[model samples]
Target: MMNFSLPMIFSFFMVLCGLWSFVKYHKHLLNSLLSLEFMMLGVFWLMGLQLTSVGMEIYFSLFFLTLAACEGALGLSLLIYVVRSHGNDYFSSFNLLSC
Candidate 1:
């Protein structure tokens, strides 16, 4: 039990670090998107560990991975669109009220 708990604790800290990075460097679109991906990966790792320890089917992890991939693709597309439209990925140039 001690061994299992140690890894679980480590994974939790991994997720927290991802969250911290996301909050710390959220001014740029690309940085925030990368941080989000990092968080997703950490969560995926945690889910896999928990599921395996519980002896549950691992299919859910695959599904979660698929969603993460889709999310990453979408974020990249958005980043591209923003860069093309605004000439950069900085949030200050977004101009949310401009329509």
Candidate 2:
């Protein structure tokens, strides 16, 4: 069994909080996006700690960070488009068929 360290514990807590926030505020796109960003941060921190603990290279974490950046850019662009079209940022207002 792998031993948990302080960074790992902190990361886990952050991820749990983020997930809870996401579930509790799913109807609010901004809130959900913020929660998702927190979750991604937790993942990055945990992965970095794991890599350092095992004496492995950090390339994978770097790649994941890049991918996360791209995802954020795309997500925000989509959100902007939705807000512009509907004049509101609620997830319930989105309808693919209507677009």
Query: Model 2, 24: alpha-carbon shift in Å?
Result: 0.5
Q: Put down candidate 2 lDDT per residue, 10-84, tens digits, no spaces.
A: 999999999999999999777888899889999999999999999999999999999888888887887888788
Candidate 1: what lDDT? Answer: 0.90
- lDDT tens digits, residues 1-99, model 1? 346587778788888988998999989999999888888988999899999998999999999999999999999999999898899998988888875
Alpha-carbon lDDT, every model: 0.90, 0.91
- Candidate 2 deviant stretches above 4 angstroms: none
Stretch of 10 with least lDDT, candidate 2: 73-82
Worst 10 residues of 1 by lDDT: 1-10
TM-score of 1: 0.91
Q: Candidate 1 — which residues are off by over 4 angstroms? A: 1-4
Candidate No. with top lDDT: 2
